[model samples]
Target chain A: MDEEIRARRAACTDTFLGNGLIRPRELLASIDPETDPDTYGEGGVVTELERHVAALLGKPAAVFLPSGTMAQAATLRVHADRRLSRTVVWHPYCHLDQHEGQAHQRLHQLIGRRTGDPEHLIALGDLEEVAEPVAALLLELPQRDLGGALPAWDDLVGQTQWARERGAAVHLDGARLWEASAGYERSPAEIAALFDTVYVSFYKGIGALPGCCVAGSAADVAAVREWRARLGGTLFALWPAAASALRLLDEGLAEMPARMRHARAIWDALAGVPEVRVVPDPPHTPMMHLLFAASAETFRENARRLAEETGLWVWPSGFATGDPDVVRAELSVGRATLRHKPEAIAEILSGLCM
Target chain B: MDEEIRARRAACTDTFLGNGLIRPRELLASIDPETDPDTYGEGGVVTELERHVAALLGKPAAVFLPSGTMAQAATLRVHADRRLSRTVVWHPYCHLDQHEGQAHQRLHQLIGRRTGDPEHLIALGDLEEVAEPVAALLLELPQRDLGGALPAWDDLVGQTQWARERGAAVHLDGARLWEASAGYERSPAEIAALFDTVYVSFYKGIGALPGCCVAGSAADVAAVREWRARLGGTLFALWPAAASALRLLDEGLAEMPARMRHARAIWDALAGVPEVRVVPDPPHTPMMHLLFAASAETFRENARRLAEETGLWVWPSGFATGDPDVVRAELSVGRATLRHKPEAIAEILSGLCM
Candidate 1:
């Protein structure tokens, strides 16, 4: 490949694979360089950003955390303490269970009861079947790894009420709740109000620098703040990344619905491709999985090659199905990715398969 | 107080309490505002900063995380998984056990055996008494809440060997390791080499933005990276604040000893004060506590008032002594806080007592 093409391919792949491409010139235009550090400290810009997020989510307060790991762990820890129970109930595929290095288990000693069937979203019936006394029931809206499937609105409300009746707090693992909101055709506040606490990320659908916020009642948030400090989450200084998030919050949130619409269109277009199979067909949100009649290794190699040739990037690996010859890839249509039409993406996949 | 004075007091208190004030100008000056998003992410300037930290700590790689909570929790989780043991041993005052809301217990389900007397630093003899099969022995170099005391160097090495003999990993809770290194007259790399894993903070003695690094053998760090991502530590980006830490790595590491020297001097001077009694007298590191002839509430109120009047901030709460009239205050002498001479701080305290 020519050097220029390789560089382009690398740039495109880096953007699509990571948080997104940071255009140096564009970012500088938005923020004042001189005040970045101080603007992120106590009573600084990040604090202001937290207030904004709290209000947006209909919560009394919010805190900007460096990562979702600490934010979610801290939130769940508070809930467990308040209930005086160490058991938290959630789907088996919940991020806290699978991704947190068992932090929920290792750091907090909070036991988990996987309340739902593995293959589906948590239903109201699933909540009723859990045998253990749960301190909190975590709901992942538009569940990832399940092709962004969401329980029906009434079912979600019913499940929340079910947990409440049993004196369990409901936490929405809304890491992707931005995208899920579009699927539910509700406002962010509407979705947020359904749970006692909600965790939202700046980087996922919002495309900002990495950060997360946990929003809840004043007392609960104050308790989380204390826990945050104890856990060393209270940094002496925060980067003004939250400033960038404020901008993304304004820019990307409005575009999420359009991205979700585009995702459905992409699903429809790709369904006809002989070599492509999507899970949870017609994805409920702006994300979906594309299974290909190729090994993961082969798919990645081909995807890399295609990027080199076309300056576009697509994931080529995901959960394994039964067949050794097949591989899955997540297709997340963000604002930038949506620039390339669904038909164009389908055509690229078709070319690669051929 | 006049509004202007009140504003000045708040600003000065914020500066005194802030972590990034030491080299804020130089730190902010080095950042490239023109970068797109102007935030931290892979391949961003901040990633370069983490790379520099990894090399300085003699680890194969390092990642910039938001807080020590995630860093320590993630590090311990990796050790537990590798050893298939559920227990971690540490002093009762260790940050993980006391400060993290039992996150190591509640979130990770990792049991902890408090190895030593709470009032003293963990010695080799203390490790000998831990009967359970532990996954890791967590050592806090220059123990904080216990007045920055350290076990003898040989004792630490012996403890590492002791844990290794039992197939357990050794983790150093080196939040104050920078100060501890100066007191021990040892290099950071030398101290890091004694353990399977070590966690260091950028904001504490280093005076950088809030960030931490976990260092170990290549395999151990790789395992931590996997856990980091699983715990949502791997977000969209992490670059800017990490860059600030990188800039401070060279500038701040050497200044710890001066701070320690100042702390010792401060302790010596305060010892002569009629109403003040120093704990762990003569100082082990750049931190000590003053047992005051006042109540905790009175100390806090006075400290807040001093902060308001003198634009100086000192910790106002500590252990309660047997006497109702006496309270303790932790005195941490950092690079910036040491700007005012020891006599000046002691004189301020003497006046406050009168």
Candidate 2:
């Protein structure tokens, strides 16, 4: 099944997702070749990016890293070292626990404790119930695994406050903070202000080359920079990634609010499609998850047929759900989705249902 | 002194060094934009690079990494875990010991035991002296810190055999193996065959984007791949670096012999200059050290004046030696250096002396 998708990938002409399917070369082409390359993640566009991100996040400093996994781990480790507590609290579906191969424990000697239910956002009560001391509370803006849902503003504040009162530094896994910014009608800095440290990814919401930055006080960021060097995240030249981020960052941010609106339009139209359901219906951010009332095989066959007939690429296969009959797919509103009318997209997606 | 160099860097028209003073953009432009980007260091050019490197090194598998620091650390841990030993033997000036922020000790909890004299390659006698159990013996080909030196081929074979007899895996830190290949007149695979695992760097000699590959048996490479993910060396896309390496690797290897001869040409020419001395005289590799019989301040002032007058950038400052009056600079024969006659380069270098 996996091999089938690879065989047919090049057949599709238009991708129904962010930017394009294969984009590194185009991203590199967009960069200003004249920009001096970074040496060991220092000088040139890398430093410029750090300074710009620090200002955007309203933090005293920032450090660029190869991946969000590295950024988040180093930030958490720095906070833990400062507070002298190894336990860090997070939601059950957070990237650190689910996707990072236990790097926090294996590489950094930090312990991760889940505080929230698997299906819901982290609440004040969940954080308060944690009995042990915590070095940091890791919060994901627009929690990805929960279908890009962000908690209400006051509830968000309450959760952070609980950790702060208990001497735990609040750290943000803001990989999708740009999407959250549009959802909350707030600047990234406004949401970031509540956290002691923030790690935002450029590759996702910013549509840049793969890279991220951890922003916080000058002291904390300096420490992460050292950790980055130790972890080998400091490459000889980070300028290409930095330059790509610089090139697309402004346009990506400016287009997010419209993407958020576009997302709502699609969801609202899908309301008439009985076989398709959206989590966090009405769409809290520019992204959402769609549940199709069809088996995985049925969904994949439909997706392949659509790609072959219309030259339009959709999710090849989807994540399995608790119900064997249903499959889940992610749709993050982007330029291609904006090209079609909301009613038209709903019709296309409806074609996938059994 | 650093500020002065930074201020005059842009004034130079040509660089008296490898490739050029600033080379990232040119290296990127050489890559084919149509090449697919890697996803999490899998597929696309990243996999292509891994497969190509594994076959070239005569290994079963390989993994592409962002830096040699991560590659070497992961490889060492893999060997240690298999041997059930925590101690890894190395030279005092090895990258893991001197440059990687003690990552082996801090991140992996592996104890490093330096067994050789700081001034020479690891001698067979040094290995016999270590009575403790050893997990691996790390040997750097064309040892970068020691003026890009190599041990005698017979002695190298003897050392690895001793480690193998003790049930210790031999690992090659072949960061400059391309240079060493030309020096030894041996294929990289020929040298790599003596070790259980081999790490080769592309950024230094290949003049490509910053990246490296670890080649070994399928199981060991898989283990290092897992460690790479844990350490966050796995980015969303490693294509740009991988593609750049693919584009330049063949040409870089083909040019090594010429560069090696050019290095000896310069060395022989410098023999007449009286004020300059060459370490490992007559040059074993394409890279060698030039010890200037002048104070640090004098070297800086002369380098600045040379840059201003000839528009040729040279080393701004040099590593201090035991002698207060002498400073050491490395010259690795490259495209930029190839443009000049050996006598002309010698005259230019002579200008820097008191």
Candidate 3:
């Protein structure tokens, strides 16, 4: 953001948007001052998080990791070592390809095979075409890049079954699993049961500190823990992250349904705005992509105007689209978004079009 | 520890030994409750720390890493990439060889070549034997595994000069550089200037949260920062760790000289005991190894008796030596060790031999 918008954002009395910015005072406020800390990834709050997540996901064991990149790479490497195959299958838009700097191939020597099309997720047909031996298949629920899309329950089951028939391990990139549970109206354990391993994020949707948990069978988890030490994720004290996660997790779990409901309300409210288009019409999870019927320059002007007049920071920038006149923005309806009425938010967002 | 000993340790108040146990309240208590936080390893407190350490070490830049394992590996990898050589030379008992799970070899595809005798720190004579091209030579200050030994200043400069003459980058595993500074009676920057890059720890001697910093030229630090992101050390929030390090680092730095003096006093006191032998005599740093005349079993019995009678937790176990008749224990004197008079501590330690 430029100086004027930055100043306004800082001075704004209350945020109409929240990324759960972890201010030191705010982040530790929820944790006990005298809480016992963990040592070297074992005991204390780290163990508490591991056990809580394992039981919540109905897994025999779980290990809290410092990040998801290490968690998934280490998990997949374990599966590869067991199956004696280095190939992993996932969507073309998977995080391993785009965000992780290809750490799997560089660090683990595991080959990544993009099975499904980039514009869509893996279907049973996509899995059938993979005739070669595969170590594992990774699936992201409510695919964020696809505007929080989710597969039908039957399709999801069919896809997992196909991977199993081929003797391949199945893993879930359940970073937003809480949202998925709310979307499917099913318990997290029910959805987690179909996978060989599941990785969940505490910071993204939950608004807790940065950390993640990988849950699976005891042996797999033990293997991952060993890998965690090798990757240098086994810290001397993980209590700060673990304690924050433990304190806010149940609250996040309970609040996700409401967030999902608010997302739908947002879509309904936006339908009246002629210049805005909501992906999937209604969000499958708590997040969605909004295509604006305005140029990037025009969107900036509208945003700046709203910040000056309404004293609200809408967005710093909007992503450019293929067409010069259109722009795209992603909206993940959080507690802050819930505070303002959907109609009021839509009214402010419409200004971005003009 | 067994149930009884564990209970005793828990109940004991005000220890004569400190390892900076980072209980949440105690760790964060020093920071302003209203301080802003850093995001993804950038800005706010992490920036403050990076700048502070860089200036202290007289380096152009520095980047904070979650663990020393990642910090050194990433730094070595960058040096290797620049030099196009895979082999890194260090002592046989270097952390990379003894502690890490061979991550440099496993993850970075970098070969490690031991260059010195396990019993001694690397000397100029050791550097002369290296015929093949090397990417880097890692030297740990006040080598912990070797009873906190620091190379003589002239010899240290000569060794680093030899590595540079061979077109190899010199890296300092300055994990205990604070103590080394006290031992050498020189500024940290004075010693750091002999190496191309230096990695320092906060949790070990500083009593801060678990983390470390690699300081060097701007280009090298920028590269390590990229690797940190790929390694997943770049968290959504690093404020807690950075803030803790920033708050406690100066105090730890200031305390090292006094701790070093107290270490000398402890050695003098131990001289009066017949069964206890202190390594390096007067001490090269604020830490040393204590060789006991008793066997492992005898040491445990004496330790138990002391804890039960004195209500002070002591050694739960001691290392078995080749003789099996003698045991060894390491002591890194800190603020806690300084609290008790050196004579009193030696009197207590002497009982373990009986």
Candidate 4:
């Protein structure tokens, strides 16, 4: 629970859920420069990757940016500009609301109006309470903060239509859309079709170097490109990240459905444990939160001890639940989790609780 | 030039004055991951690099950002917030003024008031006429757009004093500070000490990968870091660029003095040519503007022909001179330029003009 013990566990563990802390050369070695000549990210591998992602998302065009924060902000700003409104409606737990330090207001000069409860996904009834004409309504696929829970398909469609009827653009903060798509049992493009602009991250489920692409209409993407340049999101060369993303796209996407199945299997195994509670009851996507009915100190000590003995690393500290007794850890099923069977992990959890 | 001709010329050239459009593998080969592990740019190589840059510039602290555009915008906004002023004063040709598509106004909510003549550097008297209190006075060392021209040191000091006396912060847009330092014949710290915030680019005269560091007081740098995260300038791994920058910093800084000498030598050799006019006459830094007494069409044709014949790639089009009969090219001397002697370049110029 202390800093020294936390440091020791991190230093000793080789287990991480995603792309797992690659060394510079190992990360670079994964990229093929011969097939991916560099540009100022204009017309080389970046453009190729953009086109491929655009096609996959069923959008007219796409532009790659260094981060999802910039991509989403730029996309929503473009949507807002078209409608000449400065207000964006979204759930309070959306990344733009919490993680981005109010850049939506400070940098983009847009005001955010929260529409849904932070602990749950948006409902159709949530849109009816808006008092002003909104520029855009941002929807996060799978509602990451709520353990990747998604609204029902009917409600999802109705939400988009609700915003459209108000002349508000629908934007998707689909940072983990690849993993979420498997839960819906639909192609990414089919889910993406519900939004006017969709921002997907390559780093999360794709296991690529950090980068993202905003896919939308050609005109909108062009505007985002201009904003990308303005936001300093245009890199001198994105080929390295683009090459890595291209290699992961098909592989990562194909693996997601299986990963989701693996997640469900793990959730089912753990459900019988009295000390463990899986958020959303059944896993909605490849990710879900596990809340331990234990103190933070107890959770950290047990996780550290388990890692030291088993060489399987888990987080030392839980994401805050604002409750002293309940500790939360997000389980994102990836190649790393595939190494441990669901039954074994469930047994470990039962042992840790004891 | 025709596509085939351009392709043929490019095949044999070893080019590049500034970092030279690095291929992915070649760039990767230059980095050592074992020594520089991947990070979200926390306390690893990026922190080390930031410390080194801050010390080099004689600042208390520094934070790395993905681009100069973001670095400057964030820095100026930080200054503006402290002063509760939203207006910035700078040269008409400052990068923030010309290149950034008014991101200051659009994103940062800061209005820019252009000062000084675009054809010359800022004079001390120029600051006196500002009718309103300003948030910051941004100075670009070696006034890049005006043939790398710099104001005399006394005038530069007086200009900084003038802004400070008015309770405004002074920020340095030192993208080419390494080369510009040679013009002042002063340590970088000496120049940086004249400003409250200074931004240095790694990809410019340093020839590193694309990135920048803003050096200032610890609090300001911390604010910049916060803005960096908000701007999504925090990469999952910034080690590659940081390592590349550390490699170049000492080498580039050492080479800059000689590079300045080489620039002047080349300028002097070409000064006697009837068709050529070297801006700033003797050259201010390792870069200067070469104006030709020819139309853009003529200049492009001649430069293309020379490249096709000599396997030397000159810019296809000259920088805008506002005169249809005149064209300009900026010559930035570096390791690549060292291969061709000043006399040879002059001879080539003479032949091309003929």
Candidate 5:
């Protein structure tokens, strides 16, 4: 059944527990064509969104790209070129390693040196392990795969200082920066100030259509725009995605603090369940991994049944962990999760575990 | 002023000569949300369009990319990897060289060896001059920069055979393949069948949303899909573009033959105008360059005046040729061009030249 749930998800009209973002039809319907006409990778709403994002992140400029994979790679390539070094230091479980098919090396000729354990956050000690000159240090705002874990504030500052001392540019993979912002109690600009470059996804925390923007110095962003054109990220029109992002950003960004609070309450409710475990103990962001002490087959059966009865899409089977008896699913609090009380969601998860 | 016309064109509600493709708002309105939803660069209308394009070009498979720049680079990189040679041979005026900011060399580590004069099409003799092992030979059908010129049929076959004998991949930059097909009086598949890989643009000749597809063997297209993800071209949703392309393709592709006929008629009407010269003398494709003896400054002034008075956008200033005096503009026949009689368009152009 993975195919079965995919089919069901396509047909299901119910609000679900996945990303819970607005669907494309709703997004397209909401966009105002008169004000949001197509832009050839520049000007109009696309440029406006970029400027708005740049100011929010306290950067000199920003360029919109279609994917984080391209955004990060292009940004790092810019940093690498500036420093005249090809080596990039990042965590072992970074999106670049897990998802992008070694694009940094194959496409951009940038070498990656994994500097941290896959199960933990990168430490100052991790940077000390690299014996050679590095072009850039890439850090995820909250380590995603390890269940939204963030290093101590002191460690984060020390890591940036170390990279700067070595003349290495610091880049943040701030894919969920909006959600991560609340836990830090700092504006995006305050947090982004530490890095030389930042990559943020609109589809993730902003709940917009698929696209991303890289923020940095004007020169850096200009270089990224050039690379974006080269990488095919600069479409003839980015207004649809930009308009949706701007609208969703206006609605959702301000609510992130509340969503983070709600996420903790849900975890609190689920803490008593013996068969369920939330990664990172107490959530640092509005996202966390839920480990269920149930077999994949059993989990799929319960998930299917849950969807059939409640019209809720909790866990898609493809996200299961390596062990057949243990499964993992990520919970990213959104409008749908806010609709239900913590007790109700906890009970549903508990039932699945049982 | 250029700025004045840009503002006016944005506000003017008149049909124009440039491109004359479907506007974004109109295209967005035409899309069927009930039948067309989001696809993660996978199934739905996106896949159907890819399959349709693949069949049209007689390729085993096709993958939609967000831009032609990404499509061509990814395809070339794949070919280079397969042959273990990074040198690609093409004309100096190819889009990869002049337009893409040396992305092949900078991003993909591919060395480009420019062959033939920039003013003419590449010949079999041009390939014989390359001293190194070439991974791919990229040919632009109806060379856009050279006034839509195409080599003789035997010469075209000879060039492909030369590349094949040298174990080099032959790829076509068929941005205007639809128009080029009419010139050849051959089906797109018949022309594309001679190459190892073909890149087609939806926004150009097809007048769809900005996106392209690289069609070839299953393995080759699969490799392109991988690079697409790596390059950040794999959008979480491409249905908007796919849906519009599918619709526009159904509407516009059948009219390409007629568009070509209309292009010839326009050229025939302008033949006697001494101040105007159509590039490639006897136009080879539906698209041809119109070189006006008037200076670039005068041309822009005339274009702005014409648009103000007649609500017809002839060409933007950014497309002007290198020379200050001899202005060159490309005309790609579309629905809007079909609206005016050939004599009317010729008279309008002749006035500008004067």
Candidate 6:
């Protein structure tokens, strides 16, 4: 790899690893060829790893899966089955609606009701207004598409109550719950406690290898375990990889407030730029959005050029917004990106725009 | 761990790492502390491993999910859009129906039409009889709940053609495709080429760290990728451990016919045992069902005892069949299981009956 690409990879790894950039050479130094799959057994280290994650999530059990799409869909299916209801309610922009092409509809024969307004958090009023009985209400905390905004604590409590009173289960799409918790000043357990089921990702704020945990009452989770096996989620073995990431990067939860602070600073610095417009301005969580006047293609080209020319990987490319000219870029403040102060980022943005 | 448990663990790891039981310990001989997720990076090796898997699955493209329930459900939802026809059709004993609690109906606003007969494979005749439009048709090769059997190749092709002619897509629940491939004597690519999409698992015939892959044409897989992100499958990173296993154990695919031949041998030998009944006698694939006169619980106890006494694991945990006294055990012969001769397995079964 070229020096620039190598540096970029190191920087990306560093942001995730939460240390100084780990060079390609350093990554090579860590591999053990002897431990390759050709020599391992089933239920060895992998099984122990799965067990640790299950414990951390406070679920009676956990099964390691290949993707969250399978995990969340399966979990929701279990909840729906337990209640014997066919309808699930969530916001219009909820991941299940906007992203999963309706797999639930295609595969499980379930119905999803887009309950709330497109631009706002799902409210209890939306649930109350819906005439059809639902099996579950899925709540995405600090909703990602809406720029990481979460409903108030009372609203969340009321929403849960509203769903339960109607015999529906509440599921928290806590993918970004780590960041959401920082904004709420609530513990993971505290936020998760409100919902009948909670789904949390290991990779996002925690920066572990990609994985997630769905926690709930023992019976509910047990049902999920059975569903997981039927859906082919049960692997022959798992290791402590997710658990190790949880133990190591879980400390990042404590560090999130600082990252959020940094995000706010970056947002503040960039907002003053004539060509830059910030979405959900002031930043509700560690993640914020910057809308550039340039087209997405141009914005991506400029970002790639900056990375190639200056050895800095700032801003992800090709984020979508309703507006065509407004190129959306997420400002996620990890250890590596946080290395350069808001001023440094501002300088780069200004230079790119020029 | 006790010596027995430790030995079991070592054996399992060896199976995953690609060596037979005795050589399993040799896989983990190399270790570097600095790269350990618990010691340095945010989470640990598992998290990193997930990222590698995400990339390998050709997802934009992966998450180390906790279960397939979540993974498949998420993928199904992505396929079933609200404005689109919200229906999925599969066999009667499909994992989503028998296992996932009607999640498709409860979660995605999709309806399920169980099209095929329990005794026969899904045919184009089944698809032609359906009146309502469906979003997708799920095909499980070597249908698990039924005796391990497959539809005629032309029939499978006809089913996919029928579904797509109506603008509906076809999905292959190839959980046991490896065995099915051996039975069919076709390549994975050849089998996969038939459907609009396919879901394959790593742990079954491959005997790797548990993982799965959903592959399709670029556009279809691309859509699944987007859904994966929305459903929380987009973890920050992934563990390469499962990928490592895939790299190593995929070679076993070439050797599957040998295993299938051995499975038939075991089936033939067991047919002579008075108390034991084999389904699809002589074996349709490498896996076969051995029904016993005891109940599932009794069968489990006996199997456990047998495992304790002799280092062999023969599974006959009763499934959702009608007979109470019947215990169903699947004989899935891998390289390790094949180590013992068919007569040896038969001798063990004879002892269990006494």
* DockQ (CA atoms), all models: 0.29, 0.68, 0.66, 0.57, 0.60, 0.18
TM-score of each: 0.74, 0.98, 0.96, 0.95, 0.96, 0.64
lDDT of 2 by residue, B1-354 (tens): 233565577667887587666566687786788887666887878899899999989899999999998999989999999987989999999999999999999998899999889988889999999999999999999988888988999999999999999999999999998899999999999999999999998888788889999999999999999999999988888888899898989888999999999999998899889889987776889999899998999998998788888888999887788998999999888777888889998998898985
Candidate 6 lDDT, tens digit per residue, A303-350? 677666665655536576788777776656665556777877776766
For candidate 5, write residues B151-228 as lDDT tens digits: 888899999999999999999999988878888999999999999999988877777768888899999999999988
Superposed by TM-score, candidate 5 places the C-alpha of residue B162 at a distance from the truth, in angstroms, of: 1.9
Which of 2 and 5 is the better model by TM-score?
2
Q: Ten residues in a row with the worst lDDT in model 2 chain A?
A: A1-10
Q: Candidate 2, residue A245: CA error in Å?
A: 0.3
C-alpha lDDT of all candidate models, in order: 0.73, 0.88, 0.85, 0.83, 0.83, 0.64
Model 2 over residues A241-343: C-alpha lDDT tens digits?
8998888887888999999999999999998998999988878999999999999999989998988888888888889999999999989887667777889
- Each candidate's B-chain TM-score, in sequence, is 0.88, 0.97, 0.96, 0.95, 0.95, 0.78
| RMSD of every prediction | 6.0, 1.3, 2.0, 2.4, 2.1, 8.3
Q: Give the poorly placed runs of model 3, Cα more than 4 Å off.
A: A1-8, A18-22, A308-311, B1-8, B19-22
Among all windows of ten consecutive residues in candidate 5 chain B, which has the lowest summed lDDT?
B13-22
- Extract clashing residue pairs from model 3: none
Q: Model 5, which residues run further than 4 Å from truth?
A: A1-3, A15-22, A36-39, A318-324, B1-5, B15-22, B35-39, B318-324
**Which window of ten consecutive residues has the lowest lDDT sum in model 5 chain A?**
A13-22
Best by TM-score: 2
By TM-score, the candidates rank as 2, 3, 5, 4, 1, 6
Q: If both were scored by DockQ, which would come out higher, candidate 1 or candidate 3?
A: 3
Lowest summed lDDT window (length 10), candidate 1 chain A? A13-22
If the candidates were sorted by their lDDT against the true structure, best first, what order would they fall in? 2, 3, 5, 4, 1, 6
RMSD of 6: 8.3
Estimate the TM-score for candidate 5.
Answer: 0.96
Q: What local lDDT does model 3 show for residue B235?
A: 86
The lowest-lDDT stretch of 10 consecutive residues in candidate 6 chain A is A32-41
